[model samples]
Structures are given as structure tokens and as C-alpha cells.
Target chain A: MDLIKVGMADLAVCKAPQKLITTGLGSCVGVCLYDLEKKVGGLAHIMLPDSTQAKSVQNVAKYADTGIVATIEKLMALGVDRSRILAKIAGGAQMFNFAGTSNIMRIGERNVEAVKKQLEQLKIKLVAEDTGGNFGRTIIFDPQNGQLHIRTINQGEKTI
Target chain B: MEFENLNNLQKDALKEIGNIGAGNAATSLSTLLNKRINMAVPNIFILPFSQVVELMGGAEKPVAGGYLQVSGIAPMSMLFVLPEDSLKLFLNILIGKPMSEKIQLDEMDISVLKEITNILAGSYLTALNGFTNIEFNPSVPALAFDMAGAILGNVLQLYGEVSDYALVIESIFMEEEKEVKGHFFLLPEPGTLEIMLQKLGVVF
Candidate 1:
């Protein structure tokens, strides 16, 4: 099958194709997970830091907490073992503004922290990460090559 | 100066206000997408916070939501509402994937959506301020929950009924032969409508 295009607030999993990708992550985070033996890969492009404030079950997969868990569930559905999955994450930039009280709301930093905490709780080893900066990022995950590429506004493309 | 209170006549008069606002927004979108955008007449409404969910007509409710909430020491604040699907399309267009066959809303899409909201809201506010000679600044865009209930609960708790008025404007975005609807919300102070009518010089 051709490479699938994943949209905002979405998640996707692939088995044989071995490549799952997403783009344009500002305050959002793109989490790439791969199980080499099963050749299963999953990617989640999450926006919000947590789903605790979500109003419905539908938004669970839209927030970081639910988005990551949904991705893992899809990968496991593909027969990938939870223990064998390794994670790589990118994007969480503070794009604009510095108001004091709401500044601490910091969705970008909170998203990164939420991803880390969620992955650790799931016992998913985070092998690589590229996060936190003043710029936006465009990321691609190639499961076939086990490579994740990140391109920033000012920075050139580099493998993570 | 005290802001004038909003009434039915003033509320109806400002229906065309967002037409100009969206036109300005479309200009920005054209530059960013490198495609001309044909924006349509804007849809305007005034309701309470609880009406936001019912207003977004569809069975497939948006999985994600974003907000640019600003609270001024002057006791005035603004909330910008963003849906997830339109956000995906906006980002996909920017990344050279403007015509993706299957666009699914995801986390990555929401971040970009927030940025886009920041741009649109900034432009909208600037246009409104410039046109009305009002002085206001937007706070940073924050993550709004998908659940309408919780989101409104938080707003009501902080703002206290907000004078029972909310303004929602809808416009169609036509770019590269594709048409999409974009919505903007304004919950101005009680007297904002009256001030706007006076500025427009409505004889009535």
C-alpha cells in the first residue's frame, strides 16, 4: 500500500509497509513506535497535553494521554508486543506569547512531559527524542528503515 | 469610556462585520497557501456558551478543540473556538498535502491548528480593533477540551454568564477549487454592540 497521510488529531498503524508519518507539529507532539520483530509501526500526532479535561470518550484519542494509548492499542492489535515497542518523539515548541499566569499553562512543554510520563507508565522505552524550541517542526517516520526524520523552520532535516 | 450595551438591532447590524474580518483572514491564507481564497458571506449568531456544541452541526463531532483565551485586567476576555477537521485541512494545505485523500484529525494536526488559530485570531482582532478603534490583545492559544460541557463549565466558572451573549461567525474558504467552512467566535462586553452601532452611525 502507498504511504498513508495522517491528519491532525489522528493516529495510524501499519504492519508490512513499516512506515507511518505525520507533519507540521508546533505545540503538538508526534510519537513514533516500532516493533522490529513484528514489523509493526504506529504513529500518533497528538495536540493537547492531557485528556483528563476531555468532555467525552471521543476526545480521548485526541489528547496526548488517549492518543498514545490508542496508538499502542492499534499496534498490539497488529500483534506487536508491548515490551518490544520503542518510542521516538518530536515537537513541543512554545511558538508565541509569554503572559505570566497562562504562560505556565505551557501546552508545548506539558505535551512533551505528558508523553514522557505516559510512555514510562506503559513501560515503553523512549530511545530517542527531539523536542522543545522556538520553531515549528515537520517530522517523518519510516518504519521500514527504522528512521525518524525531523525538519525545523530554521534547522535543516536531521535523523533522530 | 464605558462600552455600550448590546441590543437586538446592534446585534443584527454586526452580521456583516465578520464578512470584512474573514476577508482579511482570507488574504492571509492566500499568502500562506499561495492560492487565492474566495470567502463567502459570514454567518453570525449571539447565544450562550452552552450553545457552541449544538451549533457545530454533525454526527462526527470534532475529536479535538483549541482555544486562544485572553483575560484582561479590565475584566474583558475573548475565547477563540477551533474545530479539528478544518484544522487538518489548513495544515495539510501548508505542508504540500493540500488534497490528501484521507485526512484524519490527530495530535500533530491540533498543534498546527492552534498556530493557524493564532494567526487567524490575531488578524481578526487586529482588523476588528482597527475598524472599531478598540484596544485589546489576545492571550496565547491554549488547548481546549473536546467535550463541550467541560469547556463551557470552565468558562462560566471564570467569567460568570458573560452577559448571556456570544457571537459566532461562519465563512466559506474557497482555495484551489475546494470549499471549506471556517468559523469565528466573539464574546464581547455587554455594551460592545451599542458601541459598534454608534460607530456605524445607524440612525435607528
Candidate 2:
């Protein structure tokens, strides 16, 4: 089985029998788009919420909105229909439990919201999600079964 | 003003700043334990996100981390990480307990860990304030026992959106003998390098 690794602020597209994995996702959200019929999947590990809100950005994969769109475009180029694409997301954890008045404390929630909004904009149905909380997650998306396997240090592992 | 434009001398100034911070932290720990502890001279690296994760010993490595936001002349977010073995060593030395592998820290243990982080970060920031001759107020310290990459990635996101590279000052704490333990990281904000340099009489 081929496993394609997705780094932070990066994305990857793969087919059936291949897995897309991203590790140590704290506040950063991992957005996955899969075409079950075609057995094609793509994962985008996004750090921030919106690219348009940033002053300057060279990596579109660093933002949820842009990263999801970029992943969608790549999946489309792989002969997967946009209408057939389903979304599964994970990560966006606080990593540290702190109550600060700064925007940093809420970035995890914001990233999750931004990712869902992006999927909605692209007219893709979000099938499963594991997000929020105060822990780290490593997620693997298998295109063959269209299941996201999430592993955590304290919470153990589960398929969503 | 950016990190890339920094000359050798300017970069050295930042390393010197990191050296002072680490030294102060070591001294603080020494005072608390009533024994001498020294830290290796810190390294200043301006690396990309992937490199940062790799430097922390991969994304899923379990670690004890401290996160504090320093607000003032040289605004930055600081993270102090100690791996599992080091944390065990700290528990043994600080509390003198014969521990098992499954360490479920009670309230007392949590307090001790929090105090250790406070001493390390408080002294480090104080040295920075003295070096720059400006105020550096640190917010309330927060501690997490989690994966290194998770803690670092979350903090890096707060530093703003611009550069592909993140500046990190890494220090290794050395106790008796040559045993090296714990890591202290200072992630300065986007313009923080320029601010710190200008304060140190190095202007581009």
C-alpha cells in the first residue's frame, strides 16, 4: 500500500489502495476530499483559516479556504466529478488548554469553521468529521474505503 | 527588516540574545534546586515549517511543553519542551520519587511541572528585557503534555502569515555531567527580529 505524506500547509491527491496521512495536527485542520465511486482522495493540511484575510501568502495550502479549493481543483483534474466528491475533515485541536483573550486561543475553532464553509461553497457534502478538543491528532485517509483513521496520544485511535 | 536580510553581525546579535536568555533560565533552575546547571549555547535557525517539525523530533513525539506569549519591545511566543525521558528525570530530581513507566501526574506533580516552566520562562524573558532595555511582559504560562509538532505548529500559526521560514532559538539544558535535557524555543513575531536588532543598535 502506497502512503503519501502530507506536510503542514501542504496537500496531496491519491487513488484507491493509497493513503494520505498528516501528523501532529494541533490547531491546524486536515481537510480531505474523496470520490468514493472513483476511489480518488486528496488531503490538505491547512494551518490558518482564510488566505484573503492574510497580509501576504505564497502557500495557498496554508489556509483552509484556499487549501480546500486547491485540493478540489486537483481532484477534478484527476477525472473525479465535483458532484461526486465527499468531504471528511479532522484536527483543529487547541493542543493547550488556555483562556486568553487573543485570537490565537480560538484559531482551532476558526479553522474548522472555515474548512466547513469552504466545502459548502464547493457544494461538497461533509460526511464525517473529528475536530476541536485539547489534544493532538494524526489522521490517515484511505481512498479505498473513504474512511479517515484518526490517532491521538491520549484518546487512542478511531475511524470516522 | 525580514529574517533573510539579516547580516552575520545582526544574526549574531539575536544568538547572543538567546544565549543570555538561556543562561538566565539555567541560573534560575540552579537557584531553585540549590545546584549548578548550565545550558549549551543556543542556536538561531530560520527554518521552514517542515524543518521545524523535524527539529522537534517528528510530529508525534511525546513532550512536555510550555507556551507563553511575550508582549513588549520584542514581541514573541516562547515554547519550552522536555521529552518524556527528560520529564521523568525532572520528576525524579525535583520530587525524589521512584516512578513507574505510566506516569499519571496528580495535582502536586502538575504544580511542580508548572513551576519548573514558570522559572525557566520567567527568567529567560527577564534577561531579554534587560538586554533590550525595554519591557517584555509575559502572559500567564500554559503547559501541555502532548506531541511536539502539535504544540509548535499551533504556536507558529499565531506568529502571522508571511514568511515560509520561522525563526527559532533552541537551547539544551545540561545538568550534572554531560547529560543534556529539555529544549527552550523562542518564536519571535514577524517584525520582531527587526525590532530586536534595532534595539541592539543594528539597523538595516
Candidate 3:
């Protein structure tokens, strides 16, 4: 079994019998998209909520919104029906304090919102989601079995 | 208010602080990496955020920034930035894994960096806490671009009131069989430092 590790602000895509895992989702969001028919799944771990903040959109595919859209599109290009795609989301913890009184520095919340909005825009239902808290999460997805494993500090592994 | 004069004071403070922080960070890394980790005293600097490229000293591009941010009710708040390659090496040593071709985001790296920040930041805050008695918790570290512009830009935007003085400490990490370099930037307002020193009972 080959284990592909996804880091913060990174993403990975795999077909059946392949596995994608992302760890340490603190204030970051991880989106897992799977297609039962094609047995293909893609996972993206995005640090920031939006790519517009960056100088260029070259790494738009690395941001939460654009990354999920691109990953879904890739699955579509591979002949998987968009409607048949199931999504699982995790991470987006508010791990710090903002200088301002407002919660504008809530990048984790923003990442979760952005991913959900994009998924909704694409008409994909977030079948399962683990998001927004004061803790970090580690997630694993098996494209072949469509199993999602999530782990957190002081919290053992559990499937969502 | 000469830049050199101010920078010299900032440099001394940065070295002293870096020695304490890096010493603690090294101890933590030794436990996590399961090896004896030695960190060289930091090379101090006070410069604008845009100076990263030059500071690289013709080393390499696409430098990675491993950031550990801590905020508290205290009057002082700051961040610590670790180099990407150094972090990569540190993670490799910590996990006993061979160096990968690229430092792409991976689970091992994320967890390691996050934990590293927790350890390093905790140590730093504890050290500060002793003098100030202010409690602080660090935010999970996320990877940042090593480019001076982006980091400094974020610094400006993040702490608008605190600027013009960034104490950067450049150091090397040495284990029995390995050697790597690292950086620690202490950005504090002059007033903040003055207050902290006063609190520490260090007059001058």
C-alpha cells in the first residue's frame, strides 16, 4: 500500500487502490472528492481561504475554492459525472488570535466557507464534513474503498 | 535614531533571545528527531521584509517560511520564522526519513512543523512568561513563502503598529551526523522591548 502524504497548503489526487492523506489541518481546510464510478479521489489541503490575495492565480489550484473546483473538474475530465462525486471536508481550526477585535483573521473559518461555497456552486453535496474548531486534524482517504480516516491530537482515529 | 544604532541594539537583543529560543528549540527537536540537535548562535539583522532575497546571500530561490505565531493578553506579540530547507531537514531527521526530492506539503511535514512550533513557541513563551508572567499560546504553524516581500507585507498588514525593527537570527542545526541552518525573527516594538526589559528588572 502506497501512502501519499499531503501537507498543509498542498493537495494530491489518486485513482482506485491509491491513497491520499493530509495531516495537521489547523486553521486550514482539506477537501476530499471521490468518484465511485471511476474510483478516483483528490484531496487538497489549503492554508489560505482565497487565492485573490496572492500576487497571481498561478497557484489558484492551491487555494481552497479554486483547488476544489480544479480537482472536481479534473475528475470530470476523467469521465466521472459531477453528480456522482461525493465530498468530505476537514480542518479549518481557529488556532490563533487576531490583533483586531473582529474575527477577520479567521482564515480557518474562511477556508471552510470557501470550500463549501465552491462545492455548492458545483452542485456537489458535502456528504460529510469536519470543520471549524480549536483543534488540529489529520485525514486520510482511500480512493478505492472511499474510506475517510480522521485523527486529531489526543483524539484517536475515526472514520467520517 | 540611526538605523545602525537601533539595529545594533536590536541585534544584541535578538542574539540573546535567539540563543534562548534556539536552545529550547534544539532540545525539543532532539526529542522529536530522536537525535542530538545543536543549533549555532544566530546571526542578527534588522531589515525590511523585502530584503529576504538579498539575505539569501545567493543561496537559493523559493525559500520556504515556517511560521510560529503567538498572541496573548500581554503587551507584546510576535512571530518566529524558520527556513524551509532547515525545516525539511529537521523533519527528515525527526522522522528518520530520507530527504525527499522536493519539499512539497505532506502529512509528516505538516504535523512536524505544527508540533515544532508548539514546542519552540511554548519554550519561548515560557521563557518570556517567567519575566512578564503573561501566558501565551502559539497558533499552529503554516508554511509561508520565503520571499521577503510576501512575509514583510504580511508583517506590515498583520501588525501595522509594529514596524521598522525586525530582529532576525540566522543559525545552524548540527546533530552528530547532520548539519542544517535555521532562522528566527523577533519583531517587537522598541517600547515593547523596553517594557519587557524593565519587567525583567534589567535597567539600561
- What value does the lDDT take at residue A50 in candidate 1? 67
- Among these predictions, the greatest lDDT belongs to 2
Residue A15 displacement in candidate 2 (angstroms):
1.7
Ranked candidates, highest DockQ first? 2, 1, 3
What does DockQ give for each predicted structure? 0.03, 0.73, 0.02
lDDT of 1 by residue, B85-130 (tens): 5555666677644555544545665566667667776776677666
> Candidate 2, residues B1-204: lDDT per residue as tens digits?
566666789879989999998999999887876666878888888887867878778998988888888887668888888887777777787887566785565677667877787778899888888878778888777778787778888888875477777888998887876443778899888878887788889878
Candidate ranking under TM-score, highest first, comes to 2, 1, 3
* TM-score of candidate 2's A chain against the true A chain: 0.97
Give all candidates' CA lDDT scores: 0.61, 0.85, 0.61
Which tens-of-lDDT digit does each residue in A30-143 have in candidate 2? 998999999999999999998998878789899987888899899999999889999999988887766665788889999999998888887899999999998999999999
Candidate 3: tens digits of C-alpha lDDT, residues A70-140: 88777877788888999998877655443453343566687788888888888887888878765556678
Candidate 2 clashes between residue pairs 3 or more apart in a chain or in different chains: none
Q: How high is the DockQ of candidate 1?
A: 0.03
Best by TM-score: 2
Tell how far residue B49 is off in model 3, in angstroms.
17
